[model samples]
Target: MIPPRSNRSQPLACNILRYRDLNRIERMFNRLKLFRRIATRYDKMAKSFLGFLHLTAAKLWLPGFVKRG
Candidate 1:
């Protein structure tokens, strides 16, 4: 007995927008690196470094609210 062949003509569905999201995230990290404290190993303690990272991220996020207001 021979097996039936499946349709090969249909194109695979893809999410192109995911790549755009990834690109935006990459850009955000690149922007984050622009800050001297985050870019360099200035903070010796991990807790202090993480706190500064969150502060930097908040600074980056605050502009959107400023624009809306």
Candidate 2:
């Protein structure tokens, strides 16, 4: 996977197909469709909504991405 390039208009969006370090892969998850689902969620508390959304995204995505990773 490519590292972030700060000079761009936006941070690079990509999934890490392979990585020597797992932590490095974690940093790239935002480019993934799963984690991005948080944007659509609604909850009584803003923090509650965002936290659960992230958890759901991780639960759904981690299995799929981890397998490919």
Candidate 3:
């Protein structure tokens, strides 16, 4: 799969895809879509949208690393 690029011109090619990575990314997007704000593009600015996206991603990622007692 093509990876993210700093500029919007075009994405660069990447190494071979792993099934596990693809699965995780798909799941992440599915979870992201569950948030109406994110799915509907409510943020008018790209920066704000990206900030919220990063916030959402961080929330999703936390459970994996945090341990419960």
Candidate 4:
């Protein structure tokens, strides 16, 4: 076992960049849950369920990459 440091004077620093990324990921999950099928998990098979999930995620992600004509 490693010994703990005795001189703990300052509070721990948070990584702002990592926290921002985590927040973005959490928000994306919240958005995904807005879809009824995904929230209910209607598919019984793992392969089909995963495929549907990928399609749903792509549907959410594609608009950002695609431009409106």
TM-score of each: 0.71, 0.33, 0.67, 0.76
Q: Give the TM-score of candidate 1.
A: 0.71
Error of 1 at 50 (Å): 0.5
Best by lDDT: 3
lDDT rank order: 3, 4, 1, 2
Q: Tens-digit lDDT track for model 2 on 18-69?
A: 5436655575554443443454554668898768766775675677656553
Give, for candidate 1, the lowest lDDT window spanning 10 residues.
1-10
| lDDT (Cα, 0-100) at 26 in candidate 1 | 91
Candidate 1 lDDT, 1-69, residue by residue in tens: 122235646655555677678878999999899999889969999999999999999999899878553
lDDT of 4 by residue, 1-69 (tens): 223345767646666677788889899999989988889999889898889889999999999999899
* Residue pairs in clash, model 1: none
Clashing pairs in 2: none
Clashing pairs in 3: none
Winner of 2 and 4 under TM-score: 4
Report lDDT (CA) for all predictions.
Answer: 0.82, 0.62, 0.87, 0.83
Error of 3 at 34 (Å): 1.1
RMSD of each: 9.3, 9.9, 10.4, 6.9
Q: Which stretches of candidate 4 lie over 4 Å from their true place?
A: 1-12
Model 4 / residue 41 / CA error / Å? 0.5
Q: Name the weakest run of 10 consecutive residues (lDDT summed) in model 3.
A: 11-20
